[model samples]
Target: MKKLNIVFMGTPEFAVTILDTLYKSTEVNVVACITAPDKPAGRGQKINQSAVKQYTLEHDIPCLQPTNLKDENFIGNLKAINADLFVVVAFRMLPEVVWSMPPKGTINLHGSLLPQYRGAAPINWAVINGEKETGVTTFFIEKEIDTGMVIEREAIAIGENETAGELHDRLMHLGAKLTLQSVLKISSGEFEAIDQSQLTEEELKPAPKIFKPDCAINFDWDVQQIHNFVRGMSPYPTAWFTMHNTKADNNKTFKVFKTTLHSSKANEVPALIELDGKLILALRTGSLEIHEIQMEGKKRLTAQQFMQGYRPEEWEITL
Candidate 1:
């Protein structure tokens, strides 16, 4: 049986796992990798290699970091590899010239089920929308972003208290398995590619890129909504809010990473409340027990640790 010649393209840690799986697979030959160019990052601004690039280096695979995807020279080099297919994950949008180069076409592993959550931050949006289930999809890369022909999909249940960071890790592994399966099916010419338009007619929910302003916590929403918002953004670009600390005589930013929802409202109480050493945020219809939080310029702390140093009565969420 002839092995499929694959060119892998991705940049982040999530992409690295899939790249590793494909590299080790007996059925596919990862001929080369195309990841983001090395750039300076962090406070000291040291040059940083993408996780996929680092993996390629350690494994002695051919790697290409092209500044411009459409550059003729890069295209020339890519064509020289004569790869059968391109596998893309967590990478930048590909120009048609690049995605159309491979003989068997480019396949992308998206973080969400197709025809839904089709955008940049699918994993985060699914959690924010309080979804009970989400999954990974493998599809052929077309002209439009994420609007590709579906090849395979694998669903997973989203936990009630699961954070977006946790969901990301789960989907990362699920995507790798799904991608490998899709590649094998495609290699054997036994896969079916379904059009997105045929999937569903319901209204689509987009997963747009999240910004700092989007991460601001809104206590006006109900408890469940607030809880979902916090969980969706936790551990990275965490959900936050402004609070007035009367005892400290200052307004501080509080980043909330974990919370539990309660339906009973805290009637006639301030937004920030404490009961039995627990820090809770009272909302309009319900309350949220904040389990993990971090004050500005301070390390993250549990609810007990947070209440030890400050009085909840002196703090009120700044609307």
Candidate 2:
């Protein structure tokens, strides 16, 4: 069997996992890697190499960090590889000249099932929308983002209280396995690609990039909605809210990391409450018991720790 020569492109930890799988496969030869350029990061401004780049360096794989994909030199270097196919995971959008250069063309591993939740931040959006199930998709790369023909898909159920970070870990491994399978099928030329338009008729949901403002918790929403929002953003761009301090006459921001819903019909004015030694955020339809939180300018703490010096009676959540 001829091992398929592939050029892997991605930058993040998720991409690194997929790249590792391909690198270890007997049927695949990862000839080269294309990842983001190393840049100074953090308060100290230390140079940081991308996860994929680090892997490639450790394994001695030829790596390219092109500041401009369209540059003649970069294009010439990529063409020199003469790889059979290109494999993309969590990478930036590729130009036509780059993706179309390989003979077998490029295939991308997407976080969500094709034709649904098609965009960046698919994992976060699926959990925020309270999806019961979600999965990964491998498809051929096309002109439009995530609009390519599907080569493979593997579904997984979403836990009711699972955070987006947790779900991301599960999908990362699942995606790696499916990607290997897709590569083998392509290597043997035994699989048929299906058009995205023929997959489903339901309205497609877009997973646009999330910003800080998008992570703000809306107390007016139902308990389930608020709960979903908190978990969906937990551990990154965490869900947050503002509260007015009566004693200090100031507003403080609270970043919520963990929350559990208590559902019931209620017209109570949303506010912070302490009941049975637990900190709860009252809402329109119900309340959420905050398990983990970080106050503005304060370190993250448990509900008990947050309640030590803070009195719920002196604070009211800003609607």
Candidate 3:
């Protein structure tokens, strides 16, 4: 059998793992790597290459950075290489001219199981919605975004209190492994991509891109909601709220990382209490004990440790 010629497109660390794995396989030759252009980052304002681009450079692989995916020049270069297959992970949507070029077409590895959580930020949304399990899916890219036919899927249980960051790591590796499986099967002509609608599942919950307002914690929700929200947003674009001392008239944003749920009946004020050196947020059905937090421009501290130096008697949280 002839060895497969593949071209990969991706931009993040997650995508680099898959490309690295595929590049090592003897059955396929990764002809080229396509990633986003480097831009200035950090306080010093130096050029920062994407994780995929950095890996490509270090490995001496052919790399392309196209400011416009559909530009005639980029398209011309893609035709010149003439790869047989394409793989995408954590990359922008492709135009028909690019994705339809290869005989095997494009295969995408999504962070979440297909036909559900079909959008950006799947890992974050899964934890925020309190899902019991989540997984990765490899699918054939079609015209519609994420509405493609499924190639293969692997499910993993979500830990009772798993943070989004933890789940992200798990799915990242799992996606790499599953993508390898798909590539091998495709090379041998044993793979049959299945339609997502044929699987038959419940309603789909979108994983839309998260914004700053979405990360704001709402004390009016149930304690469990607050708990999930904190865990889901942990370590990135963290769940935050503005806290102020009514007497001092000073306000600062506090990012919540960890919390524990506790039942409560007293109709006390919401998210307003520092009883016994604990930062307590009174939710609708119970109290949320904030275990870990980071004040604006300060280091992360435990609730007990934070209360020891600060007084909540004059503090009031806004949203």
Which candidate achieves the best lDDT against the true structure?
2
lDDT tens digits by residue: candidate 2, 1-319? 8899999999999999999999999889999999999999999999999999999989999999999999999999999999999999999899999988999989999999888999989999999999999999999999999999999988999998899999999999999999999999999999999999999899999999999999998776888999999999988989999999999999999999998875433548987888889888877788788899999999999999989978989998888
lDDT-better candidate, 1 vs 3: 1
- Global lDDT of model 2: 0.92
List, residue by residue over 75-173, the lDDT tens digit for candidate 3.
999999989889999999999999999998899999888888999888999999999999999998999999898999999999877789988988999
TM-score of 2: 0.97
lDDT of 3 at 47: 99
Worst 10 residues of 1 by lDDT: 261-270
lDDT winner between candidates 2 and 3: 2
State the number of backbone clashes in model 1. Answer: 0
Model 3 earns a TM-score of 0.94
- The per-residue C-alpha lDDT of model 2 at residue 211 equals 97
Better of 2 and 3 by TM-score: 2
